[model samples]
Target: MRLVIARCSVDYAGRLTAHLPSAPRLILIKADGSVSIHADDRAYKPLNWMSPPCTLKEGDGDVWTVVNKAGEKLIITMEEVLHDSSHELGVDPGLIKDGVEAHLQELLADRIETLGDGWTLIRREYPTAIGPVDILCRDADGGTVAVELKRRGEIDGVEQLTRYLELLNRDPHLAPVKGIFAAQEIKPQARVLATDRGIGCVVLDYDALRGIEDDKLRLF
Candidate 1:
């Protein structure tokens, strides 16, 4: 990750024309070729950002241009750079990867009934051409459901579930497989997208899931 604090102005030329007046702001350049401009406030959300799969070119002096595949261009003119530094964040295995999310998957598989009455898990990491579906289950009516699990559900997660459903539904045995996007927290946009595409969104309760596991252990 590279961070640059500078007095800069920005102009974006694309579907719509937008401009940021000359001011002191923070510029973030990621390893994936994404660039974002941010003001001092607004927490984590950048004021403007170009996602990855783009190109960046540094021009003579303090000018930089970023362009994406869609022909969108972001021109940044820096009057003065206050500070510039880059840091190696190294590989991120992801948060709560081992304990939280993985355990959630295990608990959900054991307590498939939480999804619906008579729902039973067929398998975890169900295979698909693209990738593995988090869980494959059979509902009360014996219909197959392909579930995608996430720590925090976003639009991309919904898209992934959609893709798995598309592929799984092609199989005769899993024909018409339904999709469920399960996450501890789901964004409003993601929920809307899932509903629009006839997918179900499940907001998981991590603590409750763990408690269920504990209760079963106690009974045993």
Candidate 2:
């Protein structure tokens, strides 16, 4: 990871044109080749960013250019650099993840019945060509359900779940696979989109799920 705090101005040219006036900001360059400019506010959200699969080149006198395959270009001109540092974060162990979302997935998988009566999890991290589905389950009628879990459900989550359903349903055994978008909090727009596509939306309760799991463990 590379961090640079500098007084800079940024301009993005592509589908839309945007310019950030000269100001002091933080520039983050990640190992994945992604670059983002951030102000002190807005939490972790970047003011501007170029996602991975892009290239960055440094020019003379504090100027940098980043370009993507789509011909998008982000030009950054730095007036002065206040701080500059880089760190090598080695290969990460798989165990480190978003605690809440990971735990929610585990709890839901262990207690698949929470989804519906007689519903049982077939597997967690069910593999698909593009990516893994959070949970695969068999419903009461023995129909397959592909679930996508998220910390905050948004339109993109619904879209992702829809893509998984499209792929899973292609399999002979899992044909007609239903989709369920489960999240701690779901946006109204996302719920509307899911409903229109016939995808089920579930608002998960972390503490409630943990309590249910505890009760089951005690019984066993």
Candidate 3:
């Protein structure tokens, strides 16, 4: 599958965030309204790796398909995947989205506590009053953080986080310390922005959050 490029920015930290589609095309339906994902050559080539009606797995993910050799037809799809990475990674886009949210939750719970003991963390979905902040954290220290979730794609900068930062600055309870813009995938410009403004930003890859053993999901 061909990967689509999105615009992004970067910083000295090598952190990044791409300007995602207002609503990512994580899901794709064929002319028949059947579901499909955008997979790279790696994902597409093994369509027949299994039997006609078989279950295939990838990167701890699953791919399901059925073949009707009687009609020279094959039907391939994910078992329970969702999210937009279907186009790029060829996995269920929905699964990618869910993974992103899960990762965010895990990261927040495990790390937010490291910032301080008395700190209180919060979680918010995309598109808050300021914009889409996948995870928004506000601590007892009056610090706030904004996270943009990305499953996979072209890494870009956090333009939305900047807007969130502006909003955080307005909040009396969260204005003094600073805002943290976090993401699993980010662009170069985003890191630069955070550095220049003296704000904190972090970028994590899939491997980074794996095996993290936190059962509690932070409110943010």
lDDT of each: 0.86, 0.88, 0.43
The true-structure Cα RMSD of candidate 1 reads 7.2
lDDT-based ranking = 2, 1, 3
Report model 3's TM-score to 2 decimal places: 0.41
- Say which candidate scores most in lDDT: 2
The digit string of per-residue lDDT tens for model 2 on 90-162 reads 6543334498899999999988888999998899989876568889999999999999999899876886787
lDDT of 1 by residue, 1-220 (tens): 9999999999999878999999999999987577999998988767777765589999998789999877999999999999999999876543345677888999899999999999988999886655678899999999999988998998778867876776787799788799999999999989998998799989999898887634654755
Q: For candidate 1, list the clashing residue pairs, or say none.
A: none
Ranking by TM-score: 2, 1, 3
Inter-residue clash pairs, candidate 2: none
- Give TM-scores for every candidate, taking all chains together and pairing residue i with residue i: 0.56, 0.57, 0.41
Q: Which stretches of candidate 2 lie over 4 Å from their true place?
A: 94-100, 107-148, 154-182, 187-220
Superposed by TM-score, candidate 2 places the C-alpha of residue 52 at a distance from the truth, in angstroms, of 0.7
Please report the TM-score between candidate 1 and the true structure. 0.56
- Among all windows of 10 consecutive residues in model 3, the one with the lowest summed lDDT is 5-14
- Tally clashing residue pairs in candidate 1: 0
